[model samples]
Target: MRRSGATLDFDVDTTSGHPLYIPNGDLLTANKWHHVVFTWDGNVTGTNAKWYVNGVNKTLANIAGSGSRTSDSGYSPYIGALCSGCYFNGQIDEVRIYNRALSAEEIKRLYLLGN
Candidate 1:
């Protein structure tokens, strides 16, 4: 997301069926250069999942889940601005994506640089 008069930008996404759910109350705000990248492979065979913000590993309770099963290997890749029809209102600079999930350290580095 972008803000008026800001130089940096932010972009984030996840793998297929491994959707990123940014709740209405949780909005990313940046005053300068910043970027966020998220990816998931939809590996649901095991009951394990993870979430990161600005490249930092967040606790499992911090991530939103369906409580049943979440996988990222589906055919259709889920990408958008907000969860459940909520549109982002800030100016977004750039967004990038990778087919595979990023390591915890990688996410932190990206987030630090963006911020």
Candidate 2:
């Protein structure tokens, strides 16, 4: 995930080709703490992507491209950036990735736990 201006760019590379990209604007306040959760069931059909902000589902459905989500974990994940130009202009504290998509209740628990 990369913050492009006030919105976020969620990109997940797929095994069958094409990367999934989701965009949501003004989802975060500068210099403030926010809990964002993105869930995908590995099947992209221009939908089925959910964005939970602060424990509530924001209903983001603008997924670009299509394919099965990648299962390879050989590549290293970068926090603030994937390259020079595309970089998150804020601080990132902790990040967690799961094997499967988490439920709404589980995501809420995480937000509540942090608070």
Candidate 3:
């Protein structure tokens, strides 16, 4: 996804059910909050996909596929808030992505980073 205005870029894979977040436009504003989460239900192979932010989950599912791509070719990218041209003007802290659905314990961990 591309950021036109103040927003974020993300993509979800239907085959693996994994969500990927990408920062296309520019750095976030200072002293603000920005985060992202990704969950997968199938298999994740290779490292084609990665969390741009620090402290995010690296590998997700255990199932292996034929190819070594992080995302499938047929899935459409998901964009949030920001569009192309426009950019975010705030501080971004503690971006998180999970392979399986996050439990209450995991959510709390993320919250702690922001606070």
Q: Give candidate 1's error at residue 16 in angstroms.
A: 15
lDDT of 1 by residue, 13-115 (tens): 3332332333223325555333445444543321234455556544432233333343425534323333445444454555676667788877777777765
Candidate 1 TM-score to native: 0.46
Cα lDDT of model 3 by residue, 1-115, tens digit: 3333543444444444544444444534545554554443343442343323223443423223343335446644333433354444444344444456665457557656665
- The local distance difference test score of each candidate is 0.43, 0.74, 0.43
TM-score of each: 0.46, 0.79, 0.31
Q: In terms of lDDT, which candidate is stronger, 1 or 2?
A: 2
Candidate 2: clashing residue pairs, number: 0
List the lowest-lDDT window of 10 residues for candidate 3.
60-69
Off-target runs (Cα >4 Å) in candidate 2 are 14-18, 67-74
Better of 1 and 3 by TM-score: 1
Is 2 or 3 the stronger prediction by TM-score? 2
Candidate 2: tens digits of C-alpha lDDT, residues 28-79: 8888899988887766564667888899887564666655666647866766
Best-to-worst order by TM-score is 2, 1, 3
lDDT for 47 (candidate 2): 62
Ranking by lDDT: 2, 3, 1
